[model samples]
Target: MNHFIEKTLQLKDPNITIDTEKVDEVKVNGRFSLIYYGKLSYTPKACECCGIINNAFQVVKNGYRTDSRITLNTISAMPAYLKLKKQRFSCRECG
Candidate 1:
């Protein structure tokens, strides 16, 4: 499943991951595009302020923001709308 998603999405690295189980469908709203809802995250996040790397320790999911971006992939002769849950991380040590 992971391999298929990596290939389909053209993900180059293992650190960059996506949760495909969160969404059930490739929503076809009209003739313009398809919407794919998913969560996006990067492993071994680093603190923006302190430059501290957190693989697990002192790391927390502060919040997530809904983000939309244009991808090179096309679906049904239309562009793909990747609705991503962009994760925000914080470090307890930095705070």
Candidate 2:
């Protein structure tokens, strides 16, 4: 299921996992769009902002960026989108 969507949409990010059974039709800026739900998560080896190594008491899961809409190439002439809940990390050393 995940593999099918990835191949069809050309999404190569390993962190992204699509909910293949779920899809929605919605309006974006007055135009109809097709949206697919998914989640993005990964364990980081280092903090992206401060470059501090990730470990105990270092970079950790802050929460997530939810309902982020990313545009994709049109599917069957309709605008396609990915609604992703992306994992986020916070650097204890920097913040």
TM-score, one value per model: 0.62, 0.82
> Which numbered prediction scores highest in lDDT against the true structure?
2
lDDT of 2 at 32: 94
Report the lDDT tens digits of candidate 1 across residue range 1-95: 86786687676756545666753334455455655556666644677788787755777777777575646487457666666677777789878
What TM-score would candidate 1 get against the native? 0.62
Cα misplacement distance, residue 8 of candidate 1 (Å):
2.7
Which pairs clash (backbone N, Cα, C closer than 3 Å) in model 1? none
* Candidate 1 wrongly placed segments (more than 4 Å): 15-30, 53-56
C-alpha-based local distance difference test score of model 1:
0.65
In model 1, the Cα lDDT at residue 94 comes to: 76
Q: Give the range where candidate 2 is weakest over 10 consecutive residues by summed lDDT.
A: 53-62
Q: Could you tell me which 10 consecutive residues in candidate 1 have the lowest summed lDDT? A: 22-31
Residue 84 lDDT, candidate 2, scale 0-100: 92
lDDT of 2 by residue, 1-95 (tens): 77988999899999899998999998988999999999999889998888887767598777888688898999999999999998988888998
